[model samples]
Structures are given as structure tokens and as C-alpha cells.
Target: MVLSFLALSACSRDFLDITPDGRTTLEEIFQDEKRTEAYLNRVYGSMPSYFWKYGFFDFLAPFSDEAYAYSGAALGWAAGMLTPTINPLHTPQERGKGVYHWGTFWAGIRDANVFLANVETANIPSPTNRERFRGEARLLRAFYFWELIKEYGPMPIVTEPFANDYDYTTLTRPTFEECVNFIASECDIVIGNSNLPMRITTEAERGRFTRAVAYAIKSQALLYNASPLWNPGNDKGRWTRAAEAAKQGVDALTAQGYALVGDYSNYFLSKTDISSAPGDRETIYEVHEPQIDPVFSIINSIPSKPGMFKVGATPTQELVDSYEMQATGEPVILGYQDEEHTQPIYNPASGYDPANPYVGRDPRFYATVWYNGAAYDNIGGEIHLMETYVGGADQLLVAPLGWAFTRTGYYLRKFIDPKLQSGQPEDTRWKKYRLAELYLNLAEAENEANGPTGLAYSAINTVRSRVHMPDLPQNLTQEQFRQRVRNERRVELAFEEQRFWDVRRWKILDQTDKLVTGMEITKEADHSFSYKRFVTEYRALWADKNLLMPIPLTDASIIPDFDLHQNPGY
Candidate 1:
């Protein structure tokens, strides 16, 4: 995500031989306004992968602040303490937390800033078209800055863009609150004035930010502030704004034609399911990777260890337990079993007596996770990620290996597009935000702000109803309603990488530490009891404060004046 490792010329001569009309100007790159607009489009491509790839905010969403945790080797902490899931101050994993005083994010800001500055003076024709282009740049700039804000708290505003010298490291950061205000204010301007569509109508418009995208981001920022981790609404000053922003984000998308698709899997599994794609009715905004670019490959995050499911970032057992069930439209923490004495079967309909083990169970059990020894139509038809070799040796990835930790108890299946072979070149893009999430967000935020009344309850039911989950019981306490909202989010939105962020927003990383389990495996001989006792604890790791990546020590040293004070424990 940092600018490519290759260093290119800061001058345009590298691209064009000479200027026509004897106009040797830097602005020539954006000549005639049309070029300027193209410049804006190009910035999206130029976006650094840092944030998603070990960058500052990358771990923040997945690590801890408040909500839940599963003990896997967490991201960033040295002692492995500061997981991308918990208090991260005391871990060696402190990635360039302070590195921002000068890293990928700042470099990105500099580039985005330059493009935005030049865009301002371009002679674009239609004011509306010009406005849209400018708006995109501003959003990208804001996005870069927001990335900084999420981790470092605040930073110096480099609005002029980074066209200057490497010595630019001298500037100090702004106060956390100031940085928050700047991003929020700018978001409003972009949403208010830009001609961005509520839904993208073309592939070309895929990565552009629309009014709803702006709201979704703004709400996310506000929600962070409202949470205890950031002390956002320390004395209740911003909680209203948090709720208001989340509400606005959802309302804006819906007003512009966003609707929840009837099935949960469609959002991630179907490309023809444009209902959630850019310009598609369900996405408010999304980070679109060009299908042609390797970055667009969904496999990077979905495949196992090195690739196929890198790091096994499945829902913690706690999250799996969070999923609601079929027979009962409630949280099935313990799930359905064989008459409480027979045995526990995840797929009763399959009826392979355990004598056969597959029997009655929660519908989500099979859909959201890959169970130990479960069979599915893989490349050759029936293949299981847990098959054992006939003799004594590690089982193939398709088989149960000899001493495996159960691969965290549950395997994520949501983002796995069947067409994407293990290492094939699949270029379907990764969605950063979709309308389905906005609905769930609205439900959660409203529940938090108003305690499960009117809009809050209705919003939640709309989402749950998608999979036929019944309306939550009436007269439930706020705690009970809120619990439903949380679990609903886990089941309905399992692997699009939302769990990592949700834990942060609510400041409950510790709460999430308790393993949420599901889809257990068992053996058969007497045709009576069970097989294996598996849990997603496969990825569990202790918590620490270094969870917040360390500001890059190099950046801090270079910008001696840039003493951005690293996060506490790191």
C-alpha cells in the first residue's frame, strides 16, 4: 500500500517527452480539464494497499478495543499481547503505530492532496461532472486522513498535498479531536455538494464514493469516537452525532434505492448478484479493486494459511455461537443436538446414521462455517477440508491432519466464491462497504442510542427477516435486544471482515475473548455418542495493548520534530 517500492521521478518529463505550445507546465498533466478528471480517476488506482496490508488501520479493525476476542496469534503485538483484537500497548507487535508521522498513509495523503489541488484549478466543462471528479479526490484524501485518525488519533493536515520535499517530515500532528472534526466536516462537504450517485450505475463508477458512502464512513468515525476506547463522547458531547451519523448513513442509502437482498450468502458469493455491487442498489460505497489488477483478487484474503484462508481469520467460536438458528429463531449458543442424550448432528437431513451423524441443526451451522470432516462439492465433487489419509501421516488439507489445532474450530465460507480455484486468477473485487451492512449498522446504532425502540427494532427485524429469523421477542430488555443485534450482525455478516471492526467500534475486545463455538465433530463405533470435540479456539491468543501498532520508529526519528508520542504501552 505504501507507494510502490520502485522510486519514480517527481517530474513529468519521465512520461512526456516535451510540452506542446511551449507550455512546459506541471499542470499540463491535467490539461484541458478532461485530463484533470482522469487524474482523479487514476488516484483510485494509486491508492496504497498499506491499510489493508499490515498498515495502521489494517490491524485496528481486527484487533481489540472493547468487544470480543479469540486467542489466535493476534496481529502486531510483540509478546503477541496487543492483538489486532485487544489492549495492544505492551506487545512487540507494535507495527509502525508512530510510523505515520511519515509512512504509506501520509505518502498517500501527499499524492492525493496534489491531485486534489491540481483538480481545483482544472477547466472542466460541465460543473456537475467537474464537481463529481473533485469530490472523489476529496473523499480519497479524507479516507487517507481518516486512516491516520483511526490509529494515531490525530495528525497535521497536509492539504496542500505532497509535491514538496522529503524534508516535509518536519510537520507535527493535530490533536485527535481536531483530526476527527476535519475528516467529518470534509465528508459533509463532499456528500452535500458532489453529484455522487446513491448507487453506482456502471463499472467505471465502481470505486467512486457517493453520498451514502460518505455517510457510512462518517458514522463509522463517529461511532469510534462514541465508544469508550476513544472517549469520543466523554461527556455525551458526540454520542448524538454518532447516532445521527449512523442514521443518516442508512437513510441516505435507502432513500437512494439501497435494499437488503433476501439471502445472506448472495452479498459475498454472487458476482451476478449485482444487488450489492457498486452502483448496485445495496452498496453505499465500496473500495473497488480493478478485476484486472492482482489486488482485486478475493483469494488474497480468503485462501488458507499463506493464501487459502490466510491466518484462518474466521469468526471466533464466540462469533459462531452468535449466529441464530433455524428451529428456533434465537441465538443457539449450544445449538440443537440428539434429544440432549443421543448425539449432536449439524445436518440431520443428510441422515447418514452414526450409525450416521448428520442430523437436525441450525441452518447457519453449515452455511457460515466448514465443519471438521464435513463434505462439500469441491474441485472434484465431494471433498472435505478435513479428510484423513488412509495410513499414518498428516492429513491432506482436504483431510484431517495429524496434529492440527482444528484450524480454529470453524472455517470461514462466506467470501469463498466457488469459481475461485485454490490458486487461480480470480479477479472479483473485495467490497469495503455494502448497504446490507448499513442496515445492520442502523440497527446496532439505533439500539445503542434509543434502547431498541421503533426504528431500531424495525431496522433489525428487516435484516434478520432476510434469513427468516423471527422478529425478536417483544418486551425484551435493552441488554437482550442489544445482544440480538450483535449476534444478528455476526450471522448475517460473517466474513466480509466486519467482526474485526465491530469489536473496535463497541470497545469490547475483551468480551470477544470468550470463544464462541459451533459445528462440532464426532466419531462413530457404538452408533451412540460422538466423535471429536472441536472449537474455533484454533486461533486464540492472549490480549495486550501493543494491539495498536507502534508508530514507525524510523518516521519518528527522521522527523525529530515529529514526536507524535507513540501509543502508551507500545
Candidate 2:
């Protein structure tokens, strides 16, 4: 009989461990230094690589208003068809049935527990290495819990592994605040460990956890704790905690010589292989996956051409309108006049013309989205422009009428390496946490804690200046600053999986997720284009119940006696 107490790490990359032959017992595995290192790598593997094929192909973009995936789980999610069994956010193990297996995050946590319990017995000679290993395990454990909390809210805080004879039916989840505090404490333990470096500077140690990562985790948790969905009472203390933690996180990172990248557009295309040179210091933590055939970019790069696959994720006009006009540095659209998003509340002073919408937009807009009439490439010294107008090469096609064309009249260009051609293997690694997020976190928390102070203005302006966008007006009120910060996050972190949680945490999904919009362009008689905003998709009903995902039914069924305490409205 195969008696598996914990699932071993399956990731066999250079950093992760490949279980050697003839290692049958836990005693034997931990007795050797090489085996011990391999075990720790298994803990690292527990982190679901969003860059890897399983998570990347169907990312969280479609689950939120950032973009719409024409097929797969995101499409169903957009239509409000989500349930306990059909949740795209939960059960991300794309390779298997949507079971919330302990083998994924729970398995990682279990492995970390095993490592922490047995690392002292390992055959390591270096004291520093042992402490660092312990720190890494603790940090990974904290991170796994954070992931669970973000998706499903409160969860059972199982720090140590359960015994074979342990009663599974007695498991109970802690309160949301308790879970947040527990994660913060775990991160604090790791942050206090000096053995672990602040930055993983070597290429070989590129994806390893560091103090900065722990800090990022803490900041994220605190910010979520203070958000409206969780802190419905408008708890000032929660805001204060979030503000202090974010500020501390920023200070700790900057002290370690980290800052935003010089160029905003080029940051996504920067190297993931950590070089000793001071290049792209913004990425505090990143994840990398081995390159595979028919790279991810092929799906997101462009619509179906002779060699290209259909654009899997298409940008929505709702997202495009978030960009401020460069000429006036003001938002083009204030809000939608209707829930369907067909009628937009245009800000007239911003000089935004519906017919000439593409011009004079935010610089980051050009980097993130491919719209009609925009210059895409220089082929043989001739500028190649995108023709998204009717009958054009990249024409819009409604669902059920087309497969590989843009449903929303735009293609995602945020992470696409413009330098790489079709079929070329591109770098698939993405920054999990970066300096810009930290700055934004600080700005948000500070604004909540102390109104719109100069510090808050400076924190957000730093991010704006990177893209050459004008700083927000100095005299705006607290609510005005708050809106600016949220928009800044939406555009700056577009397609980065931030908006999905932002809408939930801020409790604005009902307003933002009701429907996504798209622009339809038609070539007029004079060869000019006329633009019209149309509803791309109407999302399912987002309510207070949607503030948290339901615990997977499979897991709940396995322990029938246990309450499982499903989130309401599931």
C-alpha cells in the first residue's frame, strides 16, 4: 500500500528538487544534505506558477474587467455562471478535475510544516543555511495561507500537519481577522530572520523568497484587512495597521536598494534571470517557468493571422477608458451612465473626442492595449499599423460568429514581448510583487489613515511620473485622491491579476463587474474611423455573497460532518 503523508514537490526545474532514487523513508530523506535541499525545493514548487502553462493559459484577466477571455472558465465567470463547483478563481489546478486538492496549496503548507518539524534533524553543516531554509519554509507557509485567504476568505490555520489518526471532521475555519493576523505574524517571523537575504541577487536564486517578499505579503494582507468588504464598520484601527505595515514594507525594500524601473513600458520585458547589475530593481519577487512550444504570447499577442493563433484575451473599452488623456492629464470618462456601459459619462474638459478617442491617451495605454490606427511594428523600415476597423485584418467578431478574432476590438499587449516574433519562445516569468505595488499600497493606506496628506500625494505621484503622466492636482479632497489612487492601480496593474481582488476588496464589483464595454470602429467614406462604445459582455450578479468564494464542494463533501461554513450566496 502506498501511504503518502504529504505530496512531494513535482516541480523538477533547476531550483526545485527531483526526488532521487531509493529514498523510501522520511528518516533517510532528511538525513542527507542533498535530499534536504531537494525537499525545500519541493516547498518552493508548492507556489502555483501563474507564469506556467497551467495558470497562464487561463489567467484571472477574464474573471475581472481588465480583459475578457473568449473561451474557457473566464467566459463562464463573466456571464455570472460561477458556483462552488464551477469557480475559476478557486481550483486553479487546470491539469486536473476542479478538485480543491490538498496537493496544491494545502499540500505546500503540509510540506512546509514537515520541513519545519524535521529541518533540525537534517545533515546540514552550515548554521546560516539551516536558518535560511527554515525562514524560507515559514515564508512559503505564510504565502500559501495568504493565497487561500484572498480567494476563499477565512480558512483553517493548520500550522502543523495532522496525524494519521487525527479527526478530520473537527476542522473549523478561523475568523477573517484571525487569519489575517496569523499570516502577518508568520511573515514577521521570516522578516526578523537575518539569515535570509533581503534580495536574491544571483541568477540561480532568482525565484527564492526574501525579506522583501515577506514584507510584500504582510502589506498585502494588511491592506486587504482594511478594505471595505472585510472592514465594513470603517475600522480606523485596521486602516492604521495597514498604513504602518505598507510604510514599513516600503522603507525595508528601499533600504535594500530597490526602486521602480526607469522606463514603464520596458519593465515587463526586463530580464527575469536576476543579474548582479542594477537593472530593473522594481521586481521584488518573480516566478519563472520553463519555456514551452507555441509560447503564451502567441495566444495573447494578436488575433488569428496566417501564423498567429486567435487572441485569447481581448481588452475591454471600460479598461481602455481608465487611461487619462496625456494632453490634459484628466480622465476621459468619469463613469458609465448605464450598467451596460454603452453610455459613458465623458469628462469634457479632458479634450476627449469619441471619434478621435485613440489619440492623446495615456502612454501606458499604448503599451498595454492594441487599438485601431496605432503603430504596431516597423517591418522592413515601414511602420505597420493595427487595422481594427470593419473588414480590417484585426476586425472585431462577436462570439458564436468567430473564434480567434477580438470580441472587444482590442488585443492585450501588456506582457507581450513586442521584440519577439511568432513561434519564438518568449520569457514567461512575471513579477509577483514589485516596488510600484508597494508604493501604491502605501499611498492607499496613508490616504485611508490620514486623509490626503502630502506623503500620500508623493507616493502616488512617484508611480505616475514613471510613465510621464502628470501628478494629481495637489488640492484634491480625500475622496478625490482615493479615486485617483484606485484608477492608478487599475491602469498601472492592468492584466496583472490585481483588479480582480481590488474590486472585491473595495466592494465595488457590482458597479465594475456588471458589464464590460468595447469600442466598434468603422471606416468612413473619407477613410476616417468612427468609434462607438458597445457592451462586450454582461457579468453575473455580484453581491455581498460574492465577496468571498465558496469552499470547494469536493472538499466540503469529503468531510461531511464538518460545517465547512460555505460563504453565503454560493
Candidate 3:
């Protein structure tokens, strides 16, 4: 098999760097212990970065109702610009954009396969290292497959490295069931055969895949297969399998000392360099970026100062409305009276006063959104409240539009430090899989499989209790419980790239993606802010056809027979 690899960067740590020349043959590299480890690290680097600086620091958030991407940076899907020929996320790297695509996925898988095929040739002394390295490669290969299955539905499963003369035209896509099963089986192999530890105890191996991560992959894959988009029949068997997988995952993670941290807000900001950090134990797998990067603080956050980049992403009022009231555990906005969502049908018992909209809601709301008059930080050792009202310090930009401001009348607070200065580094880690998600996954799967069971309630409550939010009512029907579980998942997992796929998998994108609303704050002469809801943008182009991403036309043309059928409505 012929294999190609990128020349490893010299700035990378000793174990990850290879020679500058890309001509280093695989056979020659795998013969040395350090080179073999470097090859494995290269495979690890192929994992998707949902919060990279490349995609304007917001990958999937802007596509969903959670947030709005400013300046068309990551709003192609929302603007109806996504096509087989043109996808912002799948654009070529030469354009300095592409986040995930066929080329990256396939190349990553090929590298993993090459590493697996040649790892034994290396002169590594430790048996534990050899076992862990093999397990990591297997899990990463499955991860790439899982990503492909999510974006483009079914895909051809290539286990081994392809030959130079391999017939690309002969390849055919597998069934969705087969695709899901393949990912689950690969993760299973890593769990059962490999000696990979359940959790990584050392800070040095923070991002490495563990047995908890494998379980997370398996649980998530099964849950997606059981979702409405894939399992249209509401297959009880599929949900049962998914529930079981998620339960196993949760149990394994808990046994390995994984649990939710006490402080919800600070957990996200905990530094990964310390093994004893508050949230470190809960993170199963995470994507690491430069902690000091401006993308986290300046780009995707409120404009605290001048000459900063235009606000990249701003939280939507729809996301703000999803956070339940703490007093009654009721949704603030029951439903909208019109398509524009200006008239919210408020629940009388929830105590959600439109005049003072930011009071007495879920504690998570304060952590996730920076609304009008919210205390931002102690700038210059004095408390500075965010002024998003009309003509306020952080007011919404209207004319002369390129100013750094919020289009949605709200700034992102999740994963952003309020105190991070312009030159300061923020501890922003894009958590891919965490213990909380495992519980949510189990809750959703259990509720679907067996209506509103104790297991489902327990799983969901675990996440809610972490944020000190009230438990969901026990008398709810299966559908009601499902909604609560979804809401819990939404508020807890906001801005983590889950909402984009969650809406699609639940087959509710047609309802949720059409329009996103924003809070229009106007400060009165008395300095009291009056809030009005208005439509930020109309996404008429987002329809049922957008449920699945299209296989890029460029990739399809490479196959001589063109047998790789495009997704429906592409």
C-alpha cells in the first residue's frame, strides 16, 4: 500500500515532529520508536476541531438556532448558500477554510490504517505503550467514519490502506445500518481487545482516547442510528440497544471516577494542564487549541474594547428562552404567537416578566448568555455591566455594519472568560465528549425505549442537579419527558456543536431552523432597558432537504462511474 503523510511541524513537541521533507517512507519511519509514536500523533491530529480559528471560531453553532455567525463567517448554511458545489465547511484547505470534508477524513483514516499496519515494526520497549497506541488508532479511525456518517449519511468503509492502483470507481456506499454497526464494532474492538486504560491519569495524555471515549463513541453512534432521521420506524430495538450502550458508558465513566464538577461556570474555564483540575475528570475526549488564542476571547465574544475583530458569534434569544425558570421549572416562552417569534406566549406560573426578562431563570443562563445590563467583569478593578441596549456601550450595530457588536442582542458567555484581557490566555478546551453527555445520551435513549422510566429520570436529573437546576416533574408523559431531556441537553450542551446535529437527528430542523429571534433592547430615559423580540434573519432556505449534507460534487466526480449517490435534495 502506498501511503502519504504531511511533514510534521518542527514546533511540535519531540514526540510529534518528523523531518521537514514529506518523502520519509512509512517503512523507514515505523522502524524507530519515536517516529512510530509521531505517526500515531498525526492520526490524532486528524480529529475534527469544532472551535478552530479557521472557521471563524464557530463551526456548527451558527447553523443551528443557538447562535448567529456574524459577517457570513460561518453562516453559509443559514444563508441558504450550502450546495454540493459550494460548502463553507468542506471548502479546500488552500482557501484557508475547510473544517471537515472527505479529503481530511479519508486522509486521516489512511494514516491511522498505515500506523496500525506498521506499528509492530517499531522498537518500542513498553508493552503498555504499544497496546495504547494501537487502541488509539482504531478509535480514531472509527471517529473519522462516525463523522462521515453524520455529515453525508452512508459512506464506503475502507479498513485497510488502498493500493496506488486501486479502482476508486468500483467503491459503493454502505447501508446506514452497516455504517453505524461498523463504527460501534470498531469502538468495541478497542474496548475489548486493547489494554487501553479507562481514563488517563496524567496531564500529558489529556487528549488521548480512553475506554470511556470508546464507550461514548459507541453510545452516540447507536443513539444517532435510533433517532428519527435514521430510525424512522421508531424501532424499539434500536433504542434499547442505544440505551444499553449509553448505560454501560455512564457506568464505566462513573466507576473510573468521572462525575460532574461542583461549579458549573468555572468548570469550563478550568485549565487542562492540571490533572487535578475541576472539570478534567469529566472530560472523556477534548480538542486542544492554543489556550492563548484571541479566537476564544476577542473574536467570539462581546467587544469590550475598540479595534477588535467583529463579533464572530452571538447567542440567540431562542437559546436564551430555552433556559427554564428556576422558581417553577417551567419554560419562560411556551410558544410564539407568530412566525417572527415577537409575541411569546409566556407561562404565567414561571414568573418570567418581560419587563425584567433576565431574572429568576436557570443558573446556567447567567453562565451562558451576556444580556443587557449583565455584569461583565471587574475591568480596571471596577464592576462593568454589559450595555447592549440601544446606543449602549455594547449596543447592537445597525448602520456602518462592520463594527464589533452583537447581531442577536446578546453576547456568548459560555467558554469565554469575562476577565480575559486582550493579551491574556483563556483556558478554552473544546470538549468533544464529557460525562454529562453520557448521562444525557442514556436518558434520551431510555426514554425512547421505555417510556419515562426511573433510569431516564435519574440520568437527566444528574445533569440538571450539577447546575443546581430543579428536577423535571415526574408525572410527565414520554413525549414530555423527551422534550425535557432535549431541553436539558440543549442548555447543558449549548455552543458545544450538539444542537446542530440534535435538531437534524430528531427531525425537528424544519420547525427550529426556519427563523431565529433576537432580543432588541431599548434603554429608556430612566435607564431601564425595555426588551422587544425581533427576527434577526429569515432562513427560508433551510428545509427538509437540509437534513443531510450533500457529498461534495468535486469528490463525486473523481469516481469514474459516479456511483456515489448524492444525498436527497442536494
Candidate 4:
């Protein structure tokens, strides 16, 4: 009997011991192509669930100034994340939890390593299939490592399964550059592989790794490596390399016939179902969950009215002000006059009417944010007007009833399918990488390398043209253009979990995450609404050490030399 049990459960700290079972041994598993494919699938299944579940917070927007949490206290991770109390011992669920299989991503890495080592020996009939499987395993390994680096900054890069007798404590983290090089090389392997198709055609293989996915990963990794957080020296060579890599990924995606599809708002609504015809062409990589009713995702972000799910995440006023006026394509508020932050310096060209605050704004703002008096379609095609003003239906002043309402006088409108009804089953995919992001990435990198070149403007304009927004103004200096690109990224990728990381990578967390503000709406007898912008008592704590998450305390405790190996200020 070849006992098949070398795989470690996700939570096991006894790294080398795999539970013994009566299943077939590694040899028998590899001999059968179907079993080997199943093993690879298991590795792919370890990818983190991007949606909210498993004690994880799905919307990272709250961590930034984009939003605030109404019911985040229900989840320990979410609650800890919003406060300054977060520590190495109680990091987000991305770090390992108590013994049971909860937050350990290393098990997935080990599985990928095992697959890479043995797949070459498997007796697969088709050489192309075998090579493709190998390519996928390599890409997965890179992805797992990327996840680690994204959180802990630098960590050990294990390429092979360890033996029981091997001393695990001897393992130490490599330099940041080494880890980057390792991940980049693995991506290159997948991209250069001939057996892997550029795009998977069979419906069953839709979510599998492909050449385009590899390029996307490569572009993201290069962009991170070139960021200010990682590149302290401000190397122009690094920025140039990142720009070239992003351009290559963009060019490859274009060659594969990828383009922005549908209206910006409609693209998200149409993605409610993968089976929806004329599938999203903008998606380069996405996490597809067909059986999941993604409508549950909006339960907390929506109004807490009758027949509605619970309200949780609420949009913040700071984010609302980021949107530009549609008429002038400029920010509604240019800047504040005083430190009290109550006075606003409105842009004369913006045509912003305080009486009708939400009108004449960027189309995307309407698509993304639900403000006072906004009409929302409920479960049965009934239109409900949001009354966020005082004593109104969704006002924050109604004691316990108002507890569920938005603190900022606005709710999330993006990603909620308006067509979805109560008790209806719907599915949504989180686009891990899309053409728009690549365009933004290319624009940022090009501006950094060559300083406001035509390539930079062209890349940014491509994204703007999709929403019918005007192109960036001409004759701006490099610094001015850089700020414009940064703002563009914030508005374009709001609530998509980009701002949380982007702020950190640019080392601007102090300015962006320091204070949060919300709008208080009052209704007069005439029924018109008056607004007061107040800085909320809630504030986000930021320090130099916050740029990278501390390594989990448990992992540090087990290591022989914790002091030298641990991330600083842990």
C-alpha cells in the first residue's frame, strides 16, 4: 500500500509531516495524468478568496479614506484593521491563524513546489499538456511568493518540498531584490513557454492560467519592485525596466485581442454572471465563482430598508470629492482654505452647484457612489429614493435604526447589480488584472522614466476615452502630470482595493490615511438638503513601519534568530 500523505494541512507548523492516508502514493498519482491534474487543481484552489468571507474583509477601501465600516466590528479581522491596534500577533487573516487550517498560504506554496518537481516525471501522453501543466505550476509558485512579498516585504523563497529531517529553522529571508528576481523569472518561464496558449478557449478551462495571466503578473510585480516603497534609491534604471515590462504586457494583451468592453458601469453589472453573453474583454485574469450569489457582497453596502440585506461598508466624503466635474473635467473642490477643513475652495470652472451637489459630476461618480436623494432600484423594480438627510429614511440620526445607515451620507453603488432581486442567485468575478489597470501602470512607469512623454499621455488617454472623459491637459510639467496620474488612478480604481496599496507604495499614507471626514445632511421645511463636512473623530494611525505588514509573530517565534529576521518595528 503506497500511503499518499505528504501534503501538509494549511495550519500545520510541523512542516515536514504529512498526514498518512490510504490513498495512492506520489508515484501512482504521477503515473495517472488525471490524478496529477487534480493535484494541480488543488494548488490553484488555494488562491485567496477575494470576496468577503472566512473572517476576511473584502473591501479594502475602508482601510483608506475611500470608506468607513458600519458593521466591520462583526469580523475580528475587519475590526482590528480599522484601528491602530493591529499587530504582528493579530494581523489580518492573510497571516496564519490558530493551529487549524485558517490563514497559512505556505501550504499552497509547498503544493506548487511539489507539483513542479514531479510533473516532469509524470507519464502524460501529450507533451504539450505536460509542459503546460509545468508552466501553470511555476506561475502559481510565483503568485504565492508575490502574495508573501506584498505583505511581509521579504521572506524565504522555497522552490522544493523539504524532507522530514531538514532543519526548517535554518531558513532565512532573502533580500528584496532576490525575491523580486525569483518571481520575475518564474513569470518569464510561463510567458516564454510555447505549450501554454495565449487564451484558453474551452468554457471549462476559462479560469485556468494562460500566457496573458503570466504577463499581467509580470507587469504587477515589476511595478511594485519599481515603487518608492521598495526602490528607496529612486533608480531611473529600475523605473525604465518597469516601464518596459509593463509595455510588453500591454502589447501582448493587445495582440491577444483584449480591449475595454462596454461602459465602465455596465462592465461591472454584466460581470454578475460569467454566462452573460459577450463576456468582459477587459479582464486579463479573474476569479470566477459561479455558484456564489455575489449579491450578498452588497448586503452591507446597501441601504438597510425593508427586504434589503444588512448595511455594512459606507463611502466616505473624502472619496466623493475626488471625482471631477463632467463639464470641466476638473475636481469640484480645488483645495481647502483652513486647517479646520470646513471651508472649501470650489473650482470656478467645475460648475458645481452646492444646492444640487451630485449633479454634473463625472459619469463614473454616479456609477460608483450613491448619495442623498439618489434613486435606487430595489428587489421588485420599485425605485426607492435615498433620504440620508436628518430624520429621513436612511439618516444617521435615527438611533439604532440609523446605526446601519452610512456615516458619510453615501453608499456604495459600484459592483451591485441593479437588476438583481431579493432571494435571486447571482455570480460575480473579481477581475484580478484588467486592461485598464495595465494602462494606468504603463502611464505611471513611463512618466517616471521619461517624464510626461507622448507614450504616457497616450496610455492615460486610452483609459479616459472609455468613459467619454476629456484627455489630460497639455503642457504640464512632469511633477504636475505625475500628480494627475496619481489622482486618475485613485478615481479610476476606487473601491477596487488599489488605493489601499497604492497609497503605501507611493509612501503617501501619512497624507492620505491620517484623517477621515463625513458629510452630515440636514433637511429644511422646504425639503431641500443642507450639508456640513466635518472631520470625524475616527482617525487612521500611520507610521514609517506601517508601509509593510509585520511578519506574523508565530512564525518569528519558531525561527532561531527572530530579531534579525523579523520586519522592523514588529
lDDT of 4 by residue, 315-381 (tens): 7787888888877777788777865456879988778997888988888888888788887777357
- Candidate 1 per-residue lDDT, tens place, 193-286, comes to 7476566565434456677667777877776666666664553556567767777877776776677766555455534233334323565554
Error of 2 at 138 (Å): 0.2
Q: Between the candidate structures 1 and 2, which one is better when assessed by TM-score?
A: 2
Q: Per-residue alpha-carbon lDDT of model 2 for 317-420, expressed as tens digits?
A: 88998999987889998887776888889998899988888889999999888888776553334555777887887788864844567888887766655544
User: Distance from true position, residue 441, model 4, in Å?
Assistant: 0.3
* RMSD for each of the candidates: 7.6, 4.3, 3.8, 4.8
For model 3 the local lDDT of residue 20 reads: 38
State TM-scores per candidate.
Answer: 0.74, 0.91, 0.91, 0.88
Off by over 4 Å in 2: 1-23, 51-56, 89-103, 294-307, 378-382, 423-425, 558-563
> lDDT of all the models against the reference?
0.52, 0.76, 0.76, 0.70
Measured on C-alpha atoms, candidate 3 has an lDDT of 0.76
Worst 10 residues of 3 by lDDT: 1-10
Steric clash count of candidate 3: 0
For candidate 3, report its TM-score: 0.91
Candidate 4 — which pairs collide? 300-312
Predicted structure 4: lDDT: 0.70
